[model samples]
Target: MTRRRPRPYDRELQNLRLHVGHERQGPVPVGWYFARFSRHLRRGEVVPVTYMAQEYALFRTRGGQLGMIDSQCCHMGADLGRCGRVSEERLVCGFHAWEFDRDGTCRKIPGAGRIPSRAAQRSVPVTELGGIIWFWHGSPAPEPLDELDFAEDRRRHLYLAGEVLVCHADLLPIGEHVTDASHWAYTHSPGRPMTSVQLRDEGRRFSFLIQPADADDTRIYHFRPYTLISMASPTTAVAVPQPGPRPDGKPPRMAFVAAVSPVRPGVTLATWSLVVRKFGPDWLLWPANRLWAAFLWRLVRRNHHADFDILRWMRPVAKDLWSVADGPTVRAYRRFYRRNLPPAMEEGAEERVSGMS
Candidate 1:
């Protein structure tokens, strides 16, 4: 009899890779939820929201109230997105006829008449603040939204807030854009041209400072550690202006501050609040400003697309594999992540790739 050839290990190796990665990389701790958009959700409109860095189902009622619930129905685990609705204050499951209230209470069970006292009632805790909605995924204790210090005059600035197209990238890479100054010169060049780029000799050092907002003003805040600090207004002048012919010679207008919060491991809620100074009769520059805003949006959108591709294809690299960009903000974000995020023991002690370790 002919000897049988040995089976190739490719498929088995792939499965092993996936399992090890998951065991090493546990779920990100539940953080803040994007509650503002939840408030804006319309009836029949189901949006994916994140808590504990995992996705959840977010829905609104015809009466303009919001509810966050498990994405799946309790019975048979049907996707609530497929068939779910608000009946009174409860969410009715399309399959198995189970009903869950806003608080995740089992109010009614079909064929059973009423829900039993022993049945488990699990619902996400939700809160509303500053026109945003928030939910807790960890301990039952409620975290205060007021803890994030919004600028005093944060509301005064002209603001445009919305989300970007969903991508498979992790939230950290996308959020890091805030501190990535180098991209402005290249990725954003198509829309907003950059005259020069600069980085510290050794590398960027992260420094965080809080600037108070004027009363009724809308200011952007960076959340690091346990505090929220105001982001500085964009400067109007460039160190070295573009080499080409000057168009009015004025510095490129600062569009607004864009912030990304991880709703889940791979999904992020990006909020861009456009801030513009109001000029009395100097409205002639408004058109230019608007054009610049559109350009900046395009630039950022392209950058995100690029990152999406990278994230989808590249395997995870250990922290030592890459060096932080030479910038203050970038340095600060790395420090923040190191300090706040759980340690490898909590995350599962998996050895990183040689260079990255």
Candidate 2:
């Protein structure tokens, strides 16, 4: 029997590559992203902010209101964040002394007699809640935020466990990792695997409840959710243990809220805040919670740090080989992203298909 000569090395490799991988860029999800901590920006200070792969001029007016507008001055295209000053509740361009209102309407032109209709700058909607500032992306008007959801956080007696900032190369992996139950054991907890999970898919907000394998026998434990993983938008998530005395009578785990914004296609900035409910009498509550927050912070920080290297370098697989281990929570997260892709992405996909036809 004569053996045929082996196929050319390059051609064989190319065939294998075609069958194994073909990566394409996908649209990024956009919505309200946490921009900055409210305390970071003082009154009458204008600063440059980069988010959603674009630049913005963020400022706090003398009247204590936050304003975000297009960074480029409409008059002569000067960088507003660098050459802007806040005066009289308006943002004044330093280059030509042109003044613009918080709404981005050109109010005054020093030399020019009248402000032209096209001279106005584009304004972005910004709101501050619970000392966190959020900016709307992809639209001029912001969607309504549920104030009731954060009632406990706004309480004066609450304790802040401080903030964490992590830079990611790509955001999809981190977003999906928020609710990935199987990875909990290996990535964060090590041995305590996730035993039960409940997913709540609420269109824009996807949430899930996770219970560890080593959980105690607390009555109505399954019915009463322990932890909440909420996605405010595709880029923001709030992960916190449910508020209650622990089964062992220990203080509950501190809450963590992580918000993400894309600095560019492959770079994402994630901001995290750790919080714990205050306990004890009002006078002692502050000091006690402060100490408690410090302890809780260490616990949450460890888990967060474990994910840093993994998430930073992770790449999307061409095809996911999911298994039974990847439970309902992970499946729901994938389904949510698929069903609620950004409107721009949906439009582009349609255009591509139509052109092919």
TM-scores, each model vs. reference: 0.55, 0.78
Q: How large an RMSD does model 1 have?
A: 13.2
Point out where model 1 deviates above 4 Å.
1-30, 35-40, 44-55, 110-113, 118-121, 128-133, 146-159, 189-325, 328-331, 342-357
By summed lDDT, the worst window of 10 consecutive residues in model 2 runs over: 1-10
Q: Tens digits of per-residue lDDT for model 1 on 1-357?
A: 111221222222223232222322333333344444333555545454443443356666555566777666666776564466666555677677677766666778878956777443355777544334556534436554332223223332233343433434455555455555545435533333222122222211222322112222222232111111222211000111122222233322233344444433444445543334323223566666556546655654554555545433333444533445334554445444333333433243222111222
Candidate 1 at residue 106, lDDT? Answer: 75
Model 2's alpha-carbon lDDT is 0.65
The Cα local distance difference test for each model comes to 0.42, 0.65
Q: How good is model 1 by TM-score?
A: 0.55
Q: Which ten residues in a row have the lowest lDDT in candidate 1?
A: 232-241
- Model 1, residue 285: what's the lDDT? 60
Candidate 2 Cα misplacement greater than 4 A, ranges: 1-26, 139-141, 152-168, 213-225, 243-254, 280-284, 347-357
lDDT of 1: 0.42
Candidate that scores best on lDDT:
2
